[model samples]
Target: MCGKRIDHAEWRLTKSIVDIERLRAVAAKHNVKIPDDEEDYYRHLLNGLDATAQQVADLPEYEDPRLQIEPETLPRQWFKQKPNPLNGWSHRAEIKLPSPKDKRLDNRTVAFKDNVSIGGVPLTGGTTPEILTGKSEYPVPKIDAVVVKRVLEAAGTVSGSANCEHLSMSPLSFTSFTGPIHNPWARGYTTGGSSSGCAALVGINQVKEWRKRHGLPPIDEELGEGVDMAIGGDQGGSIRLPSAYAGIYGMKPTHGLVPYSGILSLFPMIDHTGPMTTNLEDLATLLGVVAGYDGIDPRCTPETPLREKVPDYSAQLASFKQTKQAAGEWTTSAAGKGLRIGVITESLAVPNLSPEIFKVIQEAISQFESIGASVSHISIPEHLLGPSIWTIATRAGIASLGMRNMPPPLLCYPCPDITPPALSQSSFDILDRHNPASANMVFNATLLQERPDGASLAAKAMMHVHELRAAYDRALTEVDVLITPVITRMHSQHPSLDAKVEDKMKPAIGSTLNTCQFNVTGHPALSMPAGWGKAEDGDAKMPVAMQIIGKRFDEESVIKAAAAWEVGGLGLDKWDGR
Candidate 1:
């Protein structure tokens, strides 16, 4: 084993690595000193620690299931200075690993968020090596994320990595190492992030495809090639917020529905990664390919179905679309005949929600009603407190586990590519320069760690999650889907790189007001673009989205509702003031 193995009793007797100074330093930090009589007693007790650690250290590395990628899945190339024009691509996926045996994602090109590992590819988590280590280097992962394997197994071609917000922190774009990710709908503004580039690429693809289908010309030549779908991560509102701003569909499936193994996590409890696509059909299909219990992440419980048993979400949505139209009625109330929609009364009360954006969502609801779905205001008072609960429950844990890369409280896969040296002033400055939101989270954690009641406060907030979930459950009992707006405003322009932290972080404040609740409640939430809204700073019209949330593991209803509203009602890619 590690060095020569000695007798079991000898470990306790050996000097090992714990020296007198080391023990003294630890004691001083706590304002304590070992009595002279007990010095050797304590020293010997601590000396055995290194020997015990060596035993585990000498053990073989874990055989990660993510490493079982089939042949032909080798990665291609990574980009340097100039990223794709939209600043979307982190690399080019010249490698095509197709499974002729599969159909769900046959020939679809899919990009994984930079934080999700793709074997032999650099896992950026949206920062250069110089940001963390003062060297231009990045960790190339040897394993593919569980979702990557599943996507390939389903016949999807890997379309390389997409730029994400630095360390997957910000809810709005402009925090990426490469640069800002332009919103496809409004070039100089944001494509909300840390799933930033994923949304940008998918949004562009959606627009181009929609135009081509209508016999219109291509939007531009800037979008070189294309991606049909993207697998994006979400801890707070990364996926949904970006999708909302970019005018596409993004889903955060029930917490455990999609195995999160091999992806960087912000907090083990809230970690999620799901599909973002141009349309609901692709979203449903890609989600099915990546979902189900992988027997790795502990988040997946006994209730999680086996991979083979996962529901055929795309097929089910198609069936519902056909079933509704089979009635042969084109009247005002034919499409959404049996759907029940709930508007979260508290969601509309968010402090900064603009009247114009409010009207966009209101009109979306009316459109649902016009297509025959019954709508009512459903109140969950706890929703007002959701963002607060999410913060207190997750901040310290995210600081200790997410930012610092420490071991978590549960058994789950941790993407080893992310190894931070430790939390220090230098590291904090580097992180803050990239994304102030992340720095704020770390500071909150630091403050909490010093308070005696911090752990208990977090625990109590976690307990309240059950109350919040039950409240939503009660609301859902009265309706099939619960809907809310994704954000209070349209995407904003990126601040100068050297801008003040407060100024840089301004756009992200309250950005997650309506999205983070479900992250903690473990519900399936999707952001569906309802219409367009005028940009606050420009003549450009930005995409507006309304969220659709469903009961845990009931993604079928969530997808079906959105699809009906899309295909059977007002249809996708709608315009403002329509």
Candidate 2:
């Protein structure tokens, strides 16, 4: 009777022999009915009790323990998470010489971004599932990407590939599906990316297991006791952003300064690959190995040399050290004399900027003023200030080309005929809410349209492009270099999983606003780590970065200015765990 419900008639029959007599008395007081027939009444009572017990057991409080614990603390006995396809060896193999007479790069170990293909290693490009399935296909590359072949020939050995932004699309390292690129300076904050892995390996300590396998020294040993450098690519700040976040020096070089063949293409018009490293000398040395013109890359000019035949970067390093040693005292009037620095007002006016970043920029200007350099705030044309229509046009062109060129099976994965199930599902989700016929109607209209023969839309777009380039050239007239924040906002605080695509996109658009336009206009730009600031995590300080933009092909001038900043004691002293 324990406050249970049962049918009535059976209770009276069961009263003569069983505990139903007590049950009936309780039920009668509550005006409840019980089933008839002694056995039937008893069975009904049991069923009622069983049903109540089942409901209680089904309550949230009685659910499985596995779902209740934090993922980090979950038992190892549970199934392990899938290993990231993008992970690879962190150190380089010793370069075995073809002959004793062949020159070597003095035992320097070079690691390449995963997107760059090495003969046998998996080129995952962060999340190209096709590579993992043994079904991946690539046309016979006409030649090693000019940079890859050049680096190898220069006595650099390929270490294992490093992770990158998925498809190298985003500037934030965390957007990488393999893992968030951890900041070497601070463990909790993000390493700037799509060159995330390239920065991480150079910036942070390598895993002990990898060090043992490659017979290479640990990161602490390498940075503190030896030297190592990372070579990576940039499209819209990939190389520069990571270098800034990792607190290292990086150079994007002039557009087409390094050949782009055999590298994964993001936007060819804006993409440039270059070096990332802790020391300026290391960057110079690495760049010397990889920079060259390749006939395969249409953008590469034959005039560009494979290596700048300078006396040695060590000499430049020594000079920089000497300058730092001079402190506030100037040895000569030439110190910063005639140096013109322009601050782009449009870059500063972008919204959501952390006050600390602004402070760093202001402090840098004061430093320049303390010396003999002239600093002024300048405005770029409103239309040319941020990334413009060209950005979208280039990206669309690349994507369309990639899709059209992909092998039939690769394009239609998981179905190989018709559209892929996975792809169709995702596509329909975007199309479902809209009228299905609208897409076809728009396509047909565009196909059927006729317009005036001359002064066509394409011609108009070309004119706009020229106008923008002219505007940028004019803006640089009064300034030796334009200065702007590396990113509009501070580095994100949460782990990679917490960030959304839009979160990465917003900052990328802002940061690349000042950098990418230069690429379209064929100017050179360098991003230097200016300082650091408190991250949202309140544990590690994220890097504060600034960009120095120079006129087209003026790589040497941009390099010299960046050198000045590094020599001026603006570079980070240590990025080891903040």
Candidate 3:
């Protein structure tokens, strides 16, 4: 065979026989005495390496399961901006894939975050312009992602791709190239991200107004024929933050409960994808459709039971209705009776927490007593260390490692033929231009720092994460569920794009304050809107939220508690454009 180019990636061998011989010749030219035995030994090592490399090269190439083409049962319609309000559209497409006989989601319209692959279209993680513009060098997927396939089989129509934080790296939605998504409750206020668009689209008035602006007929809520749920990916707080800000129900299921096979993730351990919907019932239904083992994503915990083996969450909603608390007879109320709820004191004790938000959440927590649930303060002092742990793990463990690794053919997919989009120059350029100080800080302080330090930091963070998980697990033995404010603040106007990076980073600091810890521990958590509260120092009425955290794989307890809270008139089902 002709000599392979050393630089060609297909040639796996870095030092070939020819190159080894050249080294030997150069050593001889320098009069370096290589003993005959040593020379023969070096040649033997080279031969072994070459043989191993050739063996690998001769192995059959991997064929991605998703690349197998099939006849189209559903057609797709794409657009730049058709019915967008709130600046939430990254790209809009309508999907009508064929369904299985048990059509559970036939009445629902769902939107997916841009990171989730919708086969035959580019899966932009909110960074690649080529993908955004439909000029990606990669082949359009021939089959949908595992989650996308599951939703289709359940008869859910995909509305389109919702905008997200760039590379799903930032908690603030402003980082997306599509521009900051506006909160539906109040314009000029931000919709928290990286799953910003998912929650905003679920806003009842927001969707209605957008339809009117587009000259489309009004959404007949009576008929329930409109966007119903949105699928959101979370490394930290992407799903819950937006849900908290927009006043919708959002969940971050236990890690590995839902497959991350087709989602762009920051790290395999931290990645979670879950439902953001207007109601608990819909959230449960959508969760049922998406949560299951797909056998492709290795991040899924082996030996985990199938989703079918778990209790039907949709049916569990009715279990709450049968309780005595469903009626007004408090003396005989059986609902939430003997349920122990703990309010995480550390989450509320953040010094910057708005007084208005604190008061609202306190009042909401106080109501658990009315439903026969006992509430008390609980302390996990290490909870304050969550941000540091998340930073070290993601920046050191994921960012640094991702930089050195060769680009894969596709993210979270098995497609070998697709030329995955490179990390675009514009993505880095935007960060450099807009947040040079932050970029430099990340680059110099962590990524390019001494390699040993990076490794040590990541290792330490992981150990602390395990310790934290154990602490929470111990706390769960005392309390059935833990409660915290989803965010430190209630609401705020959007920050200016020209704002300093430090100023931009401060608001987002609290965005993941209470949420990221759960991501680290792989616990099931949900955000429920408590009620409307006045914005700090402002007249705008905005939503306040409380987070319910349950033990790992105990999503049923979390869901039941949330549903009971809502049924008791303590939860806000809609913002009502207040």
Candidate 4:
């Protein structure tokens, strides 16, 4: 019987193995080491399959007499809930327009992370079961998230919300609420999350299918014969990781450059909304619409408006094309007229990096040098605070928020029979109105005692962030732009569902260490695909992305630099090999 399924299973398994080995070979060439115990690893993989198979096999058989059951009775009032509005107007309207005549984006379908609310669609950040309820009880949001609204206005249709990590917290895309998002590029390896859905849908051509069903043109036709862009959000590499795994372009705009007023935030301080695309112009145009101040969000500053204040970006794009056409000297004069680039050595040395990432980074830097951009390595001694402080602060905030809103009993671990002991007393105590104050006191006390030393660590982390920012500023005294690998590793294998929590935490270090410091310091960082890496599976390719970090409010320079890289053909150009 197992042999009968072997052809189908082997076909699936072969594809997965090919992609996995491709990644392994890349890692090996770059000096990355994989665990040697192949049998043990396969055993672990099979165990997960066993659990899933058992669940499917154990499902009740309808004709079995012993399992026959009747529907349960319900209380009379259970069916009388008030009706919810199904098609109310959205709080904010999005603007959808075609690419401008002078400088057009290669029309590509773009998908948003669900965390960014669209007025009419369910707006779950992969958490809040209310958003996922098919009944559509939640009212249409009055306003769309700034990023969603902007993408639409910039000529991209609002296809649909992509699945995400619940509440945008987990690095692994797998969750109990929504099944794991598979990597279409490499079947067995996981697509990194919480932007997992956005990556998978676009990578697998699902976004194109959605667009076609909705009366939109295919991305290739939209992009004047080739699909060339995708857009998403980033809070700690949400955009970058998906781009890497999916083989595309992604950016995490400087903190606050893109207004995030209507988006669900994982951490208010670090959360940002940005774009991910297959090419640079799509990024530039999308940024134009979304980058502006909103009275609603105090974090938005009115000082910069690349869309309204600077030379027409479309026009500048034309100039770039003309320059290329004429074979005129490509000088930093147009974009970097005056700037400096710095590479952080500490980031490269981060532990446990897959060796392929190191090679990719080295190759990317070599590319930067060949492009006439001067490069030098530097250290932000204070950057050591990036990962530790961010974890403490973000987790404490989430824990506190949960305690405040959720009923006390809901916070405890599940129990099949009696209520769990930790929450049993609290649940009963809250039954009386008069004990509300006591409940508040208990929750507040617990929060204070348990809150991670974020304030202290952040303060220390901030000093490093500022020091690094100043260093970049000083470096800009001579050079034009800074470049570094967006992250040190490609997408890791899908984590085992049964693995211990410690194992889950290990893969995130590369993204957190290299990307989070910018959030702390408030600089604009762009992660553009730079090259391809081997996937653990042989048939698919893993992408390597590079970061272009620029001075505060200088997104135009960042966009321009990325565009040059794209035009120069330094990164993967298509979803499938051309």
Candidate 5:
């Protein structure tokens, strides 16, 4: 479309589909008023443009450099089963790493969210294939997501794709067409979603580990081999919510810390992908591999560290462990002496915060003193406005871009092979019929676009994100990290597929209120398993989670703080009902 960037003849090319009658049809389609008298004048102009489009389409396409790999490297197959037992895996694979020198992740298994691309693998995106092609065939990506490539380069084995929410929109596991992802701790209950399968896969592995450590035999529900770690996408708490619900560790790194290239973007501003694992070391190790600038993602700002400059999170945690052990403080009160942890007062007041989880997190935060860390209550009033700002700022963009199959205006590699079908009323109804949130998001977008002052409000909200970021940066100066409960409540059982829209969406209310703030502010946030709480439906226990927020790009401090607490404060085992 850039006339100056191409041959002149492409723009000047003659005669096309529309002469006069066809032109009238086009104008009518767009509801444009064109004078009948001027039809001939406009006809020639439109023909030139149409010819130029054809000429540009005829030119050789530029291939993105990232896809160039050894031939036959991606030996692939389609998943025969629709929804597996845990309903966690979208595809199953046993991909080995290329000859990695460091071998940091040798023999470790990693699960990628279904939204992430892995060459030659069918990407369900947690929705049915019929929506896109009107056939059974799903789109198979030929490019590996940046994180997927990194994991393979580090000697990790790709376990397969983890099921996610439909359209990557819902925060409940129940919405995926693949079916409800069972909680590892309690079946039939949700492992909070969008990154539903990631959490379930990692969470199940943790449960297995606990059972093995206790010398207990595996139960029927503990049959499958889940992944050692996962790479999950987060726009508004997708990664953290599932991790929290599943009783594992998930970190949404400071925006752009991980290159989001090759992944289907939800919203460029809030889009993020990061590690979710059973423990800190794995989380740290995997993050270290993926946390560097790819130079293409718009989110990877100038502030992003280069690949070599990216901290070795595993090495950093190792050093902390060494220093503590050598000082005879490995499991003693001296471990967190220099750490400053702040509890955000406004965060606790977020509506829908469960009394059960709120109390557990309070008790957990108070235990920081036992490990010699200072836990102070910090007030950031702007935190309360984050949900509203994030909504007004992103709802329109997320809808229009997603619905019409338009990419954002960011400079990044384009996935050429995949073609998203334009949403027809039938397709829209198909999606809206299953998930109320999907309809709500699109309706909200239309509501905003139709309002005379809606764009103005969105613009102002975007501007204020900077203000919110600065407020947090100032608070972070006085504290190493800020802490809060992961959200207003814990994940609940799946609502029936035939349930009313209100009933289907009831559990997701306020789920993202606390988590979405960091997505907008671009701060790194970690969701760590805090403790076990009784499920609303029964006496069986489910995991409770707490949020740890850090200054942008400072993932090392956040990881170390979690490690310090697990090692010297209330142990993760104690939190897990050990």
Candidate 6:
């Protein structure tokens, strides 16, 4: 076939599969009877099949220095007994590196979400039992993730790994194998995940109290002091949700702005990793350090190329302030001057929205208006259908792909060799056994087998994702950015430690009703604390947040808008005044 001679090995493989049970079953379904003597038929197919396999296997590997580069990392012994105030750190270290030259992030202290590989540190993604015990069965990655390396190269000190949802598959912090991540604001309340610990650590929530409770030295608190920033991975609101609950700034930059080369991925298309910070400046600086192509992730496109030098994201802030300065309106009251902000009607009107949360967002909008921004209501009806589209695509399509040794949306890190703690036949089953940490994700893969027409249903759902993305793009044309509630309601209490898996999952689903849409659309979305609202019992107050979504790859606008909101002091009253 095609002038290539069929060799003995190819012929043997074909002969072995000639009477494979699957072939017979497929033939029966198609009503095409194969002769019992099928040697000739099998021989005819071997040449072409073998050639195709060889061609794929021989495809050249992607070449890049970042892929080959291995930076110096802290020894594993350093991570075992480091401080873990707030239960945020999965591994703690004081690893510091020098940049080749002057850089914007010089001297910054940053912690990474557990899924971002940090060489010798255990990457549990907050699920693996060995990681929880501070002992790992898997070999530590020799090279750090591209973003992690970039951060160190920019002269940033890596504090350690932050705990996250089990395998980063759930939105509730309690699902982490290490235990529930307590909200800094309210001890028993949730921190909103899967970037749960990143936000808590950045917020500096509970650290001093946690230390005091553990009989450690008190933090040297001073005015305007705390951790600088944190890097978080977002695949459907992981970064933004946790930041929203913690009352900090978090960004999910356009999908390909940062490489996904060294991180665990649910589906590559919806995957993103970005910055979470207490202030706008660190958020801008961190994004500058990590945002760009590294030539390894297939998700990066030419439109979002990795730059040879980092852009000054803070310039976007300077421009906004300069315009206000020119008009003699540079004060905090003039923060949002000349900006156009749209309140998304569909997002705010979500079912079961708390009235206190509604009031908090309304106050935030008024703060924007007072700062000279023109605010209006806008409707993108299709956004209400985001949850449905996410379910079909992630559960039906993405889960199924993982089952057959494939990950969808192209370009994902190969699943590693960690044994799953569970005992299911899911496509995502990586372990020899079963683990409950991945149960929510693994079980979804069985949708194909559970339903007779599951494959067709998933296919249709992916088509809807495209349509939904287009709808968001169209709405963005009408406004500079659209604002929505980060979550439909305020953060809830953590699930009981003894809660059943199904019970834990019950509060987890649908929490991303507003934030997940941008993951599908591949747009830049930022979450900033808006204000505080009383809890359900009216005894405790918690942070409320608003999300700002901009056009694809337009991270500057999202950052600038959030900066203005922060400067206006709409949400600062709730801050502990650090």
* Each prediction's RMSD to truth: 2.7, 21.5, 6.3, 21.8, 3.0, 5.3
Tens digits of per-residue lDDT, candidate 3, 234-274, equal: 87888998888887889999998888775655677787999
lDDT of each: 0.82, 0.56, 0.70, 0.53, 0.82, 0.72
Q: Worst 10-residue stretch by lDDT in candidate 1?
A: 569-578
Residue 54 error for model 1, in Å?
3.1
lDDT of 4 by residue, 441-465 (tens): 3454456445576366546554655
Tens digits of lDDT, candidate 5, 1-578: 33444344553454456777889988998899799888876776676677679888998766566754335355555554343678888888767655764688988999999988887778887777776445578887767888887888888888889989888998888988878888888789988889999998888888888768767788644436688999999999999999988889999999988999888777889999999999889999999988899877888999899999999999999998898889887675767878999999999998877888887788778667788898899999999999898999999998877544467897777554445565668767767667668768888998998899988989999999999999899999999999988857765788888888888888888899889999999999999977777776666777788899999989989988888887643334664453
Model 4 CA lDDT for position 515? 72
Evaluation by TM-score, superior candidate among 3 and 5: 5
Candidate 3: worst-modelled 10 consecutive residues by lDDT: 400-409
Where is model 6 poorest over a 10-residue stretch in terms of lDDT?
426-435
Cα displacement (Å) at residue 446, model 2: 13
Error of 3 at 493 (Å): 2.6
Clashes of 1: 0
Pairs clashing within candidate 5: 353-488
Give the Cα-based TM-score of candidate 1 against the true structure.
0.94
List the candidates ranked by TM-score, beginning with the highest: 1, 5, 6, 3, 2, 4
Query: What does candidate 1's lDDT look like per residue over 363-402, in tens digits?
Result: 8998888878888998889999999999999999888888
Off by over 4 Å in 1: 1-13, 58-60, 74-83, 98-100, 130-136, 213-217, 329-332, 567-573, 576-578
Regions of candidate 4 where Cα sits further than 4 Å from its true position: 1-108, 128-140, 205-231, 302-307, 310-314, 321-327, 330-341, 392-395, 401-465, 536-540, 573-578
The TM-score of predicted model 2 comes to 0.66
Select the stronger candidate by TM-score from 2 and 6: 6
